[model samples]
Target: MQWLFGSDEDILKLVGRRGSFLSRIGVAVGIKDSDFPVFRELYYEFMEQFKSRYSVYTPRRVFASVDVRGILIDGSELKEYMLFLRDFVNDVVNTSGLYVNFVFASFGTSRISLPGKAKPVSVKTFIESTLKSYFAYIPVWTVIHRTGIKRARVYVDSFSTSPETPAWNELCNNNEVYVVSNGDKVNLLISAADLLLGYIGTIIKLRNKKPDISELKSYLKPFGFNDDRFRIYHVGNRDLGHIIYKDPTVKINPLLYRPFPIVYLIPELSPAGLLAGKDERKLIESSHVYEYILRYVEEQEGSLKIISFTEDFKHLSAGGVVVSLGEHSRRIAEYLRLLGFPLEHLNARELIHLYGGDPRL
Candidate 1:
């Protein structure tokens, strides 16, 4: 049968859960750690060489290396042939270099969940566990199905695993199977994974296809990916209640202009800006509204999913109320304002009552 299904000989793949983009999880096939160092050097070398010949950093020049955001040329036929891979990865896998087969998969937030959880997991735990479950099962899948491969090595792109993973435990029992993490490096394979995932994630972002997986299949065609190996693994979460960005690997580039929201203190709602000596007990008693707003910010703090140029014109209103918890409020607001966010301060009572409810400030 085709490698698409199962293979007869032992096969190995180095893989990583590429990035936790705000919307999806990008998965990449792997390269052996033993050969990664050499591969990484050549990869960067080729990028520099290409940069000298054709600049990729600037889009102002002819051909621009890009038209709008997408590349103007495929460059797939070039002798180097790897320039098609950019954004998330920069390394090259050339003729002399070990060319690790690149396969990719993406699971959107509204689709996949932590194996057992009912809700989409919190960002931190989501990052750690998702890949382990997927990476661990592939070899077992091939073996159980009688794919000819008798042995396999699955290298993962992770730094630590506290409790032993179920797949790791399974591999220990079988001499023919194994799994390992690379301690989270920017080595060749992970870099490539980054590129591949970033490409798909960008597509989802551009299309604004939140909660829809129908168009995802068409994206695989350009990559020549038709095999089950490139499983979309599309699951569904209809009311996913405010998905915070999961994978940090592929996220908004800070250099780009994006709205930076900051939590702020309410003046009229607060009713305390003029108080000289604040009573600690009364302060606590009066600040429950602040407590609620602060709680909301904590959960959604790191999730700046980013807006494209097309969205740049939209008004980004950031003058939401955050309680002045101490000396920190003014400082944080000043810093965010310097970064170009449109922010405003309000009294907790004003903000609360504006929403047609008594803040009880």
Candidate 2:
């Protein structure tokens, strides 16, 4: 009876404010059936203590933003508040035997909304895409392969925008993945995931603001929050890419590829630099290449994997066809060529032309 609980942050609404640097993040925590009761008890106790101490009543769910906004907004209390959440999370993980995985995806709203178009593409579309890419596919794949669990009961916090994509259905059918609404009265794990994602988002913000995070680092070290136990994936943003590349321990296990071959789709840097850019033409072309490859892989019925790659060069050894798009393809091809890994390099426009699809479509 393995269980995986998932929730996401910065998703209900897109951060469209000029010059905002926040990212959408999702968390999935896996635990055994026997550990569920323990986790439930720990969560209840933590909630009780938190409510009593802060006078914030969280009867239904715990939102990191709603519950800890005061602490995060005040620069003076941010550190102390982080430590408090860290201690509680550590207690929960240590006591309940929880395994954590995170995915971070950043999008530039202005870039997504093309200037001349009558209506900009909805941010919800991108959010749904990220949810499908990060939340539904990778976590389930990793959990099944790592835990040796034949099937996992997955509970995801409800998102009005998340549609039942083919990937979701395929994963569910193939792996016995069950989607439970986080709103279910009996589900406390989703709330726990929410809290963890909030903490992670704060940590990212802190890292962006200042250089000194030694205190935070020390607190997270004991629990392996930044280590192998906690897997983290960056979907697109170059900024988050830098963070993932700097820490080798948080990488996706190459062994996950043992069950099936993977197609590593590397897109150009985002306007945010080094991943997909803000240019409408390049972005659209990249999306076309991504969709074409994704459909091609999905046609194999879950026998293949496709993931977005940032700067993590080590995964090149994972033994998969590497397809790089945009101007960055040349650089990636050269790097892989030097490493003796087989490479297929094509710009987004070329891939689109080869596939006989219109980029604007």
Clashes of each: 20, 7
Instruction: For candidate 1, write residues 1-361 as lDDT tens digits.
Output: 1111111111112233553333224443434446556654665565455556655442111111122134334443332333355421333433223322322222334434533456756543443444433332332332322323323343333322233343334433442332212111112333344444445454454444432344566653454443433444432242122222233343322212211243333222233445433344356434445334433333332112112224332333443333334444455545545767665544445544644446565
Candidate 1, RMSD to the unseen true structure? 19.3
The reply for model 1, stretches above 4 Å from the true place, is 1-24, 30-45, 50-150, 171-186, 210-214, 223-231, 234-361
Cα miss at 35, model 2 (Å)? 1.6
lDDT of 2 by residue, 87-110 (tens): 666777666777776655555453
Give all TM-scores, in the order shown: 0.33, 0.47
lDDT of 1: 0.35
**Error in Å for residue 156 of model 2:** 0.6
